[model samples]
Target: MTDNRTDPPFVADEGPMLHSWLDWQRETLAVKCARLSQDQLRLRSAEPSTMSLLGLVRHMTDVERYWFRNVLTGENTPGIYWTDRHPDGEFDLVDTASAEEAFARWQAEIANARELSSGLPLDLVGKGLRGGEEVSLRWILIHMTNEYARHNGHADLIRERIDGATGE
Candidate 1:
């Protein structure tokens, strides 16, 4: 893997610190998916489990849109790979999903989300709610960091199972 992740700074202001950690988490996922074929990317972890590197990429695409576009900006944007009828399509319907498209969308969503929240105060409350409570940019950043961290673990396991490749 062409790992380009930088260790987050140990001393920094709150905003840059959080963004660095989130970016590190994002890059970790990319590294996990690197240098794998489409079929390899789509390989599920185990029986009855829909999780895969490709699915995680697709799922994170929607997740970025959901948190940044919908919740942060109140755009009401729909899922790129899912709908009301197929909520898990991002994971479950990846038998023929395009790794190219999924990665592109995921990167685009990440870029757009970063742009949308750029220079915004961490204390700024979003236009949407979570659990009937308004969420701040700080909360979203932390949540996204945690979200990616969790799924990146799954990605690590799946990648390991794919070709015995493993690392942070």
Candidate 2:
């Protein structure tokens, strides 16, 4: 399928085919998190979940890397998150981790992610690491978008609570 996602894939607009909705979601998440201060970006919505705005950025960094860099492009890079160590590593950061570092990481990952996402057929297929599974390029794209769509909404609410800022 041809990618025509110049606009969103809604209202039956026939301009861009929107072969990958996740593309929209990725940028949407970034837009939602944009302009937030370091502290405000790192603010949490709950004691149990450290899903801060910055955390979402970090997590999305991992997501982009996981799907685009690792799964799609088959990169051997390790995840920034760990299984047992610092579960909230995505959120809780020392002052030593400057905004430039985090932003740089995300930006670098995003550039690679966009490259990976750009050069694939929508029906492309690959085997997942678990259970001899198979996944299509379409599925991967949609799943990434779904991940961002959900978390971005969370970020919206959290940011609103932080400073009454709200929008799609």
Candidate 3:
């Protein structure tokens, strides 16, 4: 896959720098999934593990919606894929899942997250609480970057296993 991720800026204010790194991580995941067939994407990493590129996309979509829309913006929305009865559905149910739909949902979540966060400052506290503690927009941003970074590492191994493709 072609890694189209551009380097984040060397010098920038805190907010822009964080967003830049997050964006780069997002693009890196896309690059990892690029040019792959649905079967390739849905291929599990190994027995007893449900990790897959398509599953990661779906999981991230839910993560974005949970944090940005539900938590940060105080929207009372349910999760995109998982539920009490079908937890881990994003990763477990992939035999018939549509990659196109998954990607579309992921992209939409990203756009909505960007729009919902546009005017908020880093210091602004989120409307939702984590572990009974208030969370800041800055923390969410950093947490999300870390989330993507860790998942992208898994994506790297899965992609390489799928087609022997490897890179940044």
The lowest-lDDT stretch of 10 consecutive residues in candidate 1 is 128-137
Give the number of the best model, judged by lDDT. Answer: 1
Clashing pairs in 3: none
lDDT of each: 0.94, 0.67, 0.92
Model 3: how far is 91 from its true place, Å?
Answer: 0.1
lDDT of 3 by residue, 1-168 (tens): 777788899999898898889889999899999999999999999889999999999999999998898779878788877888889989999889999999999999999999888868999998987777888899999999999999999999999999899998
Best-to-worst ranking by TM-score? 1, 3, 2
TM-score of each: 0.98, 0.79, 0.97
Whole-model alpha-carbon lDDT for candidate 1: 0.94
Per residue, candidate 2 scores C-alpha lDDT tens digits across 1-168 of: 122234565564222234335556666666666776777777778888767777777877777777766666556677774334775566665233455566778878878766765656777774344245666767676777778889878977887888787776
Screening candidate 2 with a backbone cut-off below 3 angstroms (N, C-alpha, C), the clashing residue pairs are 4-16, 4-17
lDDT of 3 at 8: 92
What TM-score quantifies how close candidate 2 is to the native fold?
A: 0.79
Q: Write the per-residue lDDT of candidate 1 for residues 98-159, one digit (tens) a residue.
A: 99999998999999999999899999999988778898999999999999999999999999
Better of 2 and 3 by lDDT: 3
What value of lDDT does candidate 2 attain over all alpha carbons? 0.67
Those runs of model 3 whose alpha carbons end farther than 4 Å from true positions after fitting are none
